[model samples]
Target: MLDIKVLGPGCANCIKLESLVKEVVSEKNLQANIEKITDREKFLDYGIMVTPGLIVNGKVLAMVKIPTKSTLEHWLEKESSI
Candidate 1:
């Protein structure tokens, strides 16, 4: 399974990014667990300096902006194949 975490302060962009990840995962039929981490300390623990960050399987995939659905889908598909 893919482990995905969204790190942010529950802002608009943060929520949007989380939503986008969900949409992509569903559209691509990815078996993933999406988590939202809003705690400041936890975000720092993940080494996230920017809000709206994406951590996939303990690795940081993106930060600060919502990624395109196609990009996210591609990523999920790749992870699933591995």
Candidate 2:
């Protein structure tokens, strides 16, 4: 299964990112482990210097800006195969 982590501090962008990830997972019908990391300290562990970080399978996929649906699907599809 693909492991996805969204790191943020309960901000609007964070919430939207989390929701978008969930939607993509559901739409793609893939089994994934989705986690929301709200603790600021966790960001440091993930080497994230910005809110709304997207980590897929322990690799940082994005930070700050939200990824497009196609971009997200591509990441998810690639990671889920591994």
lDDT of each: 0.87, 0.94
lDDT of 1: 0.87
Which 10-residue window of candidate 2 scores lowest in summed lDDT? 33-42
Residue 9 miss distance in model 2 (angstroms): 0.5
Give candidate 2's error at residue 71 in angstroms: 0.5
What are the runs in model 1 whose C-alpha is more than 4 Å off? none
Stretches of model 2 off by over 4 angstroms after superposition: none
Prediction 2 global C-alpha lDDT: 0.94
TM-score per prediction, in order, is 0.92, 0.97
Residue 23, candidate 2: Cα error in Å is 0.3
What does candidate 2's lDDT look like per residue over 1-82, in tens digits? Answer: 9899999999999999999999999999999999999999879999999988999999999999999989999999999988
